[model samples]
Target: MQMPLLIAADWLLVVCAEQLAYWLRRDGLPIAVPTFHIPDVYLYLIVPAIFLVFLHESRMKFRAFPLWKMTQAVFHAVLWSVLAIIMLMYFGHVAQVVSRLFVAMTGVFAFLFLIAGRTALAALLDRYHLFEVPVLLVGGGDEADALLSTLAAHGGCGMHCIGLVTDARVPQKAAARCAVLGHLADLERVIGETGIQNVLVTASGADSDEQVRLVRRIQPLVENVVLVPDLAGLPVANSEIEGILEGRHIFLRFRNNLARRKNLVFKRLFDIVLCLLGAPLVLPVCLAIALAIKHDDGGPVFFAHRRVGQGGKEFPCYKFRTMVTDGDRILADYLAAHPEARKDWENDFKLKDDPRVTKIGAFLRKTSLDELPQVWNVLKGDMSLVGPRPIIRAEIPKYGEHFADFCLVPPGITGMWQVNGRSDTTYEGRVRMDSWYVRNWSVWIDLACLVRTFAVVLRREGAY
Candidate 1:
């Protein structure tokens, strides 16, 4: 049902985009006063068919996919379809009649339409549980709880946990979320009774041989058996598995993306282009904020703090001043008076309520307008638009071994931590996120982070 519905939605959206593109090229933004040559029926049919074929090959289905993964898949499908259309036009000698602008417009419209359509479809399905795959969890440990939380966080993933089957001691919190159906020995009976189609196993404590045997034994009883690997806090984006000796020996390989010179250059170019294009908007807002800060208090508008950049280089990271001149003194006095506040500051380096922030500064911080000045750092090659968060020297020791990975890429104004939960995330969590971003950095991930940053800022989530 999910697959069929998705196919229908995708076809409809592609057709609509073609018509919209035709209108835009012929009527909305006409290139010349020449008569328009309407696209042939076969051309329209073939283009959509190509898209469907490519999307099918990409495994567009009811499953869990992060935003970047979905975007990458959809973008490739539309791109290939557009290229095929161009080749057909040239080979059929219709390139003169079929406007190149029309073809270009169609590809742009199709990409947007397909992404929007799929996102809406997922939301609708999640809201009604229309195509959720009910599965039984086979563990009751921390890994199992984390998987459950992930399912809850990504409602559109289409996975639903009915119950659990475990032999180990189940945590009280895990039991509260989902009941234990039966022990490992009665797993077959529980599945038969419940008629579950999928089983998700977390073989965290099991040896390799036992895990393999357990999976082989369960293969005959379930439609799908998903084995969760115990590789938390590792880079998965650029990792691949290799099989040798007739699939007897398998090895996982992880690539350090930043180690390649081309990737580093691409990232720099991405940052510069985005910063330049965004300057017109950013400059005006910065000016307004500067005036507001000056009106609130006669202090310097811009603040530059020392932060570690790429290659362990020290640079001045700029931001709009959001605190009083005597911020340190005020913090010391306040922490002395309020002993509980000291713990929060030590843990996260942030305070929900602080005495040093001015009225205008608080609003700037909440909206993240204070970080607008960092665009200069981006243009200067000291920072990126999306990478790890900049850390001060005092916080270097906290990252420990992960600090090497953190310095691989320049710091960013917004990154994984900012989008996840700016001030709400713990310092250790921030370090882990930074490490992950450094390892799994890609153009798609950066674009997705930029998109989510808007929603996070607008919602004022985890802001101080």
Candidate 2:
């Protein structure tokens, strides 16, 4: 197994991190560097050893390979590593023997070096197609095909599809890229021969009884088994196990920790701090935009429309007006004449070539300059800096089942929907994305979304 190799790499990375930290501290702050020295550097070996213990204890090292998950593991590992160093110093009666700055620098370096090493190793493995887990699928359908394609598309996923075990003699196109090893009855024999460690069951059109039997049989044989929950359509946004009965079943909920007061406190604090820092950078551009709007259209520079906000409360969502004063009238006449335009409006509530937009408005929309005013919305707490897009009262039913989840947090000026496909995404996709944002909200995710928004805007994708 590559498990031992990964562990070994981690240990070496930790050592390199500590050495680099010591060198940096010595060079960068020579005056601040401790003049005293410990009896032996060998005593510091406990840091890496502590990392291994915490990695196993926290089980952070054992999760499935996702970049985000790996990042979290690295952070947690480094955190525990620091704690272990403190404990070691305390217990060994050498608390003052080591420099505080050394410990802090080592912890930071460990995080950076470990992540860099893991990333480099994964890239090498992916490029050379080495150290990949061989696996086979046991299904045939769109969902089955999509899963196979997804794995094939992402090399870092670490699974290579050797073949598939289908219900038929020949596999479909989804599994056609591989091979039809055999039917469900041949699963055990095929796995035994091929040494397949992972089995992803996505057998569509097969009888439920056959699926149950296959699961029961395959569970004991395979090292890893993943059920796709095909019966339910992608398991609602932010859905997680609420509870479970002993040896029976589990319950799921669409909500998470949105009610945590501390989380909200941090979220609000972040918004306020960010808004203050960002205001100066955008102030000049914003003033120029207001002047342009006034010069071009002789109308209001800022637009404020009632939008459904947190808890179904109405708040004026502000924007630099990008449409003509008679925008509504223009849209009505256009939609009445063009079924295509109306259809698009009914679906995504947007027009690709909206006639109601002024020339400056089009430019502002494409460049996303029009959203500058919504920073005020974020400042006022009516919206977040990153969240679901603000909706109108009429669009409430469009959120449907996800309304409560959507309302759990304030809408954001820039969010998952904006950074993703924006108006190009299907209405259902947008709603589901909002639900996902609510479910998966985190400080890192919010920051990531904000960063991605810049790139998306530059690309001008899904801009109307």
Model 1 score (lDDT): 0.85
RMSD of each: 2.2, 5.3
Residues 185-248 of candidate 2: C-alpha lDDT, one tens digit per residue: 7889998999887888886666768778778889888898876656444435345675565736
Write out the backbone clash pairs for model 2. none
lDDT string, candidate 1, 1-464, tens digits: 78888888888899899888777766787364246665566446777888899877867553577777787898888888889888887887654576788888888999888877887788778777778889889866888877777777677379778999988878777787788998988988998999988988988788899778778878898899999988998888878989998998888999888889999999899888888898888888888998988888899999999999998999999999999999999999999999999998887677899999989889988999999999999999899999898988877889999999987889999999999988888888899999999889888899889988988899999988
Q: Report lDDT (CA) for all predictions.
A: 0.85, 0.78
TM-score of model number 2: 0.72
User: Cα lDDT for residue 327, model 2?
Assistant: 86
Off by over 4 Å in 1: 30-34, 40-44, 93-96
The 10-residue segment of model 1 with minimum total lDDT is 30-39
